[model samples]
Target: MDPRYFFFILFTLPTLLFGQINENGIKGYFSFDICEAVDTTDVIFSDYGGGVSGNIIRQAGAMNCVMDCSIRGNSFSMNGLDEQIVFFSGFQSVFNTSDFSIGFYFRPDPGVTKMNLFTKAEMCADSASFTIDYNPSSNQIEATLAQNSSIRTKVTGKLDPDRCWQHVTFVRDDRNSILYINGEQADLATASTRINAKNSSVLVLGSNLCIDRFRGLIDEIAIYDRAINANDVDDLFFHPEEIINRDTTIFLGGSVQIALSKNCADSYQWSPNAEINDATVAEPLISPTATATYQVDMISSDCTAKDEIMITVLDPDDLDCTEVFFPKAFTPNSDNLNDFFRINNPYTIDELISFEILDRWGSRVFFTDNPFEGWDGNFDGQVVNPGVLLYRVRFVCKGVEQTQVGSLTLIR
Candidate 1:
């Protein structure tokens, strides 16, 4: 080939294969961000390495998963009788044999037994050509390939899937198959075989060969045609993303109204949400059933801030809502300190429908919708007589509507 032709071939190949291999060597990726989904019916996964799009097959079991706030994504749980994720070859070939690798993030639930995270095997084959899994009996991560009844290459890394997130990676060559957890090598062994693509070979996620399905959270799956290095793995682990820090407690099946930064943030958003009555306010209310992190995205004119508030919802019987305080009397004689009779636990009340003060004859004299406001001893424009006045406070607490009735003394 001519000198100019040689240079053209080198430059053109990478550009043509943009979806296959780039600087990072990623060919297929399923961040499972859930935010990237168009809907449940039209499942999709992006190809960050090769740029080729793929489809996810909800083979068996509900696609329900938990939002893993630790790494800012999702961890799918295959607890349903037969829940699993599959990528048919009709979507695209995501794995190859020579210098290939597969990886993902996972955290096993409590009492986990044996759980498989990723697999791609031909139907009716004795064993999957490729798979990465976690075995509680050994407290290790393992990879397997080749014929059925084949032994898995184990990598010893005793991780508490119920407590923290773990990143798992597998790099394959002609012989040794290396496994990594959170960018650190956990184990190494000579892989019995490399995965070969076939028409019947389909990609399975969160399950083991479509049997003995996994029951844990899995996310951020990717495949490469070449080996991924340790530095690259570390980079993948520490990639930049928005950070939100929070810790909150609520009654089981209860809600939380998180206060966003009121310092000029123009936009607000909440995610991994359920039972959300509003999302456009500085303080949106969320009621989550599980112990998960709630994220709020606050955007200002120039910058945006992301915050994560971890919510631990306990059983309804475990809560004790006892925030009640009020003064017995007040004198609105311009004496500032004792002029107003304010309501206690203002923040605890979800809605202060009304705070009413009535005369001895049951006539409403002073009224307010703001709980912070207090009576100023004025009925219309005139000061009321110095005597006992009735007050009725109506508010919602922890989803229960309540009413507080009492009397306060008014003095000149």
Candidate 2:
């Protein structure tokens, strides 16, 4: 094999790398192709007849497998009923390597279902060994290594399969094995079934014993001759096309235009039911009637990404209507200019304290008992003539007394 292919297989076979050791210590590592496939019929090792299907494909001149499977159903399962349907490549020689590592890339279909893919022995006997399995019943992926028959280290969680393709790696030093998901250290298992496999014993995949076979696809199986590090596992998932960074927002109208970080997907779907259908463009203009949260699912030929935003429609009639104040001055005259004294009030007043119009002679000309009633240059049922009128007013505001004094010009 070419040197580049060998390096590719060494780095990209496991999803994660852990327990990296130097010349002084023991180190473990692993990786796999999330989109590639492995064919067991061609290899000379134990053949459980496990093959690849669905989005599984081959990369040219690369030693890893890549899976392009879509996330539709609740579970991604491999039919292990037929022994050779799905299995690993080399389980017999798992312990022969003094320092070893393993990793693989996977995108579990949404929902619940468990599957097993690989296992290894420490010495020559299979009595005590390590195993990695996915439990669909519990929505957890777990790894078990032999520390003792009584106690072992195991890590499990409900990982959202819809998020993205994730790399899972586990590394075993002499004393302990560390689990890692997506380049991050996970829980550790100290007391595990210690591996005891003989040298030259073939490594096995797809089956734990004669049963417990894997019910999913496998690809890019690789066993490093030496231990590797976490950085090595991260490289498998660092494809330039897999990183998606886009800013998505929603306005009153259902219009979305997001610039993606990479170019792999060509279609998008907005949530909250858009007015127009069949609009699969990356940035589609849509209008939703009610206020709602919207999410966009971007689909590539091989993978999918999604984001969400919220939309809220406001009522147009929600306006401001407050009291408007006009200067307490007006010239009421027959000249057709400022013919009336009025107060521009937009709100209803609760009370009228006092309203009085006084002439220049310092005598009251008019007064009002109603807050809405304004002086029309009239007093005692008689129209007052043109002159300068002084008005003194007092009113109660919020139970507090307030007063104002102004003059009005009446010319008629």
Candidate 3:
């Protein structure tokens, strides 16, 4: 084995051990650090010797480390005999005996006509491998995996070929193998295959058939010795961010409930004080009397986490009318005190249809359609002499008829 291969194998051993085990004890894994044909000048390293590298020419907001490799003319190629480009990592050595998974960001080189990007293993060589390749003539990205020829799976698609990064995964459980692209299961040639390879070699990145190299970008390569389910893969692809931040404003007498992204810590703290602090509590009810700002902070076991929602409690009555109303007499005496007869009901009346004042003679001295336009003891827009007047009011209240009749002394 090449010294670089030995070092790669040594570095990847921990991935097989770190994953949470299922009943069958399988691990998941991935990696994309190989000297393929594609350039790697602008790759961003997450840690020492690990990060993302690929050529992204078009799509804006394309991740620097996580890019589509199958775009532009850039690609991984292997033309020389015995030339091997190891492009991926995170695969367990033994197959058929242990469940395992591999996932990474990939982009197919549009220029290549035939390509494969997955893992495979050959019993003849006692090797396991994964590969991603493209054929320029076919305009396809093919993924293949094998364990000593005993277990093999292949999936293909007419990919975007625009060199845009897409997420992909290949998983092997006790009885099945699957391929996923962009977090969804892609078509496969087979689902069930028995692995017979023992002590499989370290995972290969970038190349499969010793000279068949991938010419694209790869990022966030991860591997697990444990087999992961569809839901797990979905979570990994869609909600990779550790923290969740949200904000909500609710009316008084109303409530709000928040849902955090998955795989988050179960510890929670709600500001303005909550009835409960448990993270999984659904619909934690809180009734705030006054306007309050509530916050929920969640902490994961890894001590890395985020918060969801700054809940702002609003006062329902803040939108209510609080003005005072008082009974008044209209004198029409040019005295400001009783010049107009008006009732104050700031919260009660929206509009008045008609308000009229009639003399003992039964003639109308004042009438108005506006609630604000009260009886100023006027006739035809002219002030009338002060005297006792009978008033009749007909108005609409809450879409209903309301009639009020009374006598008022309009003194001059």
Candidate 4:
């Protein structure tokens, strides 16, 4: 691998990185290539991590094992009868966390219903478990994380597979559960639940403990200890090279041109065409009024790669010359209109530093630091004689402070 590839993979943050798997938080990676030897019976070793090897146990059906690099390189083909690949060790601590991601590429056999694609659960008793399955009854794929047979979060989405390779991933990031299909977010839910898989259960692929056996070709399976971001998922789905610039930032009212490397893709489709000059072109000029994220699908004959760029728009806050008004006069006679001596245009003020009202002798009769409170033309529990009262207000507007002094006439 070129040294530049490391630089691109380590630093660049995008929706997808092409050609390589993200190794930042990877716990186990199974490519199932020809290079991985089967030492005992049908045990296939994981390429990057040990102790999570595939122990193929075929109770019935003919065996089909082959390597195909075009579609995610080498695959584990299942015959759907009673065949499964079980990993009997080293996954208890991997899935017993608050953040994790599991992804793979699979091409299911046509008409396969109620098949379990992946599972990690204890069959003896109801405990914390995780599973992903395809149901023909609902024509949907469901991903569930549960405890004691009770679902913590279950996300379901449409997955109409026509015997073609498709990528699917389930992620748990803190309280958020996300499911991604073909580099796009399919479903999302929020739940801060713990998945306690600290039992004698093991991880199984292509079946759920010998039940609901999956008939398909599975490849490029990966497990991450942390939540693999959408960008990482895209990179895994459609491996592409560095074809565009990193995310950009611009001031409000400014324009930017997002361009791709020369000869990256045969066709382009940019989303959120609102503020861009052209959405069908590789390089479009955009002048968005607010901060927004733009995603573009680079389509070629081989694969469709997707990427996104976030444009952060900054608008500074400066003080405006609109002053807050103090009522010039008011009547305490109980008429609703102008009955209290209060401040007007209070929306223009952000904070009240100090507000005080005093009589002619300079003695404080009413005082409050609250901007919403005002005097009601009363002093010593009785309405003061109709006379002029002094008011001093110190307040802040748009983070800048200013003081205003004026006289208010009280009427009976």
The global C-alpha lDDT for each of the candidates, from Candidate 1 onward, is: 0.60, 0.47, 0.49, 0.68
Task: Mark the regions of model 2 whose C-alpha exceeds 4 Å error after superposition.
Answer: 1-78, 83-97, 107-113, 121-126, 191-201, 208-211, 220-222, 239-243, 246-268, 272-294, 298-412
For 108-194, candidate 2 gives per-residue lDDT tens digits of 434344555556543423345566776767755687654345544555545444444455666665546666765567666554344
1-412: candidate 4 lDDT, tens digit per residue: 1111000001222223224667787666666654343332333333555334345665432334446322544566777776776765556567775588989877666663588988887762456777889776765779877666654778887763322456789998876779997778999987656555455567777765635788867777777879999879987775322336677766578988876643335678888889999998888998988889888776655445567788877553432434768767898887677877777745456788888898999988888877678788787897788888889888887668898888989877
TM-score of each: 0.45, 0.44, 0.38, 0.50
Number of the top-ranking candidate, with lDDT as the measure: 4
RMSD of each: 20.7, 23.1, 24.6, 16.1
C-alpha lDDT of residue 349 in model 1: 65
- The true-structure Cα RMSD of candidate 4 reads 16.1
Q: Candidate 3, which segments miss by more than 4 Å at Cα?
A: 1-96, 122-132, 135-141, 146-151, 157-163, 188-193, 208-211, 238-412
What is the alpha-carbon lDDT of model 1 when measured against the actual structure? Answer: 0.60
Q: Which one wins by TM-score: 2 or 3?
A: 2
Best by TM-score: 4
In terms of lDDT, model 4 sits at 0.68
Alpha carbon lDDT of residue 386, candidate 2? 73
Mark the regions of model 1 whose C-alpha exceeds 4 Å error after superposition.
1-23, 34-53, 59-70, 73-77, 89-96, 123-128, 147-156, 160-163, 191-199, 208-210, 239-412
Worst 10 residues of 2 by lDDT: 47-56
Q: Write the candidate numbers in order of decreasing TM-score.
A: 4, 1, 2, 3
